[model samples]
Target: MSWFIYALKNYLNFSDRARRKEYWMFFLFYMIFVFVFAFLDTALGKANSMEEALDLEGLFSPIYAIAMLIPSIAVTVRRLHDTNRSGWWILISLVPVIGILVLVFFTVLNSDEGFNRFGRSPKAEPAF
Candidate 1:
């Protein structure tokens, strides 16, 4: 999907606004890939137990996760920016359950109309 590729291309860009569709589509595809890799690992006997599966102890899945880690954070930060929140808000997820719930609430919110401070809304059409 274009959205997934867009996120990957901007993998290190944490200073822009990302539309909700972009963020969610990347997330959807990322999870799908993780599952696919995990299945391959199990089929190849790289992961032999439920614990290993849960721990993602496999060649493909772990490698994929490592490769995508920065992109995931970047997109999440950009998603927060779209909502007009500071990227530092991502640290809120460090507080366990409440923090994660709060972060989810923030990410699911609609982008601020026009712009507050981060930049133009990703949902806005460019003027010609």
Candidate 2:
């Protein structure tokens, strides 16, 4: 999906606001790809054991996480913006435990009815 491509291309870009379409598109691609790969990997029986399969999975995790970083941050910022909160609040995730949950809650929360400071609105269709 477009979001996946955008995320891969903008892996290092953490600024700017991302609309829901972009964020969800990337999420959709990620889930589908991960699931398909996992299913095939299992069917192939390439690794001798589950642990080996897990180790193999680990090798790609860094790349996958890197691919996901930009959209994650961008979307999170926009979500924060929706709540009339500064994007800087994303930094709160640096805290030990509670911070992670709080930040996740905010980013995963649906956007407000209208725009705040980020942009017009998330309702517009992306130019795919």
Q: Pick the candidate with the highest TM-score.
A: 1
Clashing residue pairs, backbone N/CA/C < 3 A, model 2: none
My TM-score estimates for the predictions, one after another, are 0.93, 0.58
* lDDT value, residue 60 of candidate 1: 84
Can you tell me which runs of candidate 1 are displaced by over 4 Å? 126-128
Sliding window of 10 residues with minimal summed lDDT for model 2: 53-62
Alpha-carbon lDDT of model 2? 0.62
lDDT, each prediction: 0.89, 0.62
User: How much is the lDDT of residue 50 in candidate 1?
Assistant: 38
58-87: candidate 1 lDDT, tens digit per residue: 888889998999999999999999998999
> Looking at candidate 2, what is the lDDT of residue 116?
55
